[model samples]
Target: MTTALRILLLDDDPFMLELMTDMLQGMGYENVRAESDARRALAALPEFGPDLLICDLSMPDMDGIEFLRAAAEAHFDGSVVLLSGMDSGILRAAETLAMAQGLSILGACSKPVPRTDLADMLARAWQQREARARPPAHGGVK
Candidate 1:
């Protein structure tokens, strides 16, 4: 079930994009798309309608921050995991900004993200999606 969750990976470095794609597929997630440009990623959002987004902070064109804003404007509802080589402080700031913009941020991690960590994040995202899909319980208050 989790394997069917659509995922989008956005990073400027071609190597990082390839690595992340391989990592996701290795984890049994085959519904994944890799984009090297933020603008192109944004354009693909509507059609892709990803369930999760894994993105990098630093990019030559349209950094992750800007991409977040644009995504918010586009009303993207998928969970986000920020992967960057930047320091912790910057990652924290980006996470906070993303939350403020109403984006569902799963978490942030430094570059060279471990496979276990990525798996954990993906599990969390799947759990969240399941929770959202569940019908609310009604107490015997009526």
Candidate 2:
């Protein structure tokens, strides 16, 4: 059987973290890890090896933007989705930074990212990953 895709969720707010985790689980994402501590979340990357990461932009100690930079530096190739209630100016800057770091950001969404939206993002990320994994038309000869 094919292995389930792993996902990491980083949010300083306990409520948001739990909510997102439950939403992911309800959506049939089995290997979902939620961490309220940004630092710990970063550490879990190697252990979890998640295929996708959803991080809150306004976290406590180390915000999501910083976390994204660190994760990218560590060579994480997973898709990233930034969640925040910040103004568009902040999100625009974050998006630019994410792009410069070569991070595959699914997109930035407003706070309390609806469960339906989360599910859609997860599905899209999964499909994108599958596409990347497919062999080229020329096969191994390419």
How does each model score on lDDT?
A: 0.92, 0.85
Q: How far is candidate 1 from the true structure (C-alpha RMSD, Å)?
A: 2.9
lDDT of 2 by residue, 10-116 (tens): 98899988888887777777788889998998899998888899988997779888999999998888898988989878988898899899999888888888877
| TM-score of each prediction | 0.93, 0.89
- Candidate with maximal TM-score: 1
lDDT of 1 at 129: 76
Per-residue lDDT of model 1, residues 69-98, tens digit only: 999999998899998999999999999999
TM-score of model 1 (CA atoms): 0.93
Best by lDDT, which number? 1
Model 2: pairs clashing at backbone N, Cα or C within 3 Å: none
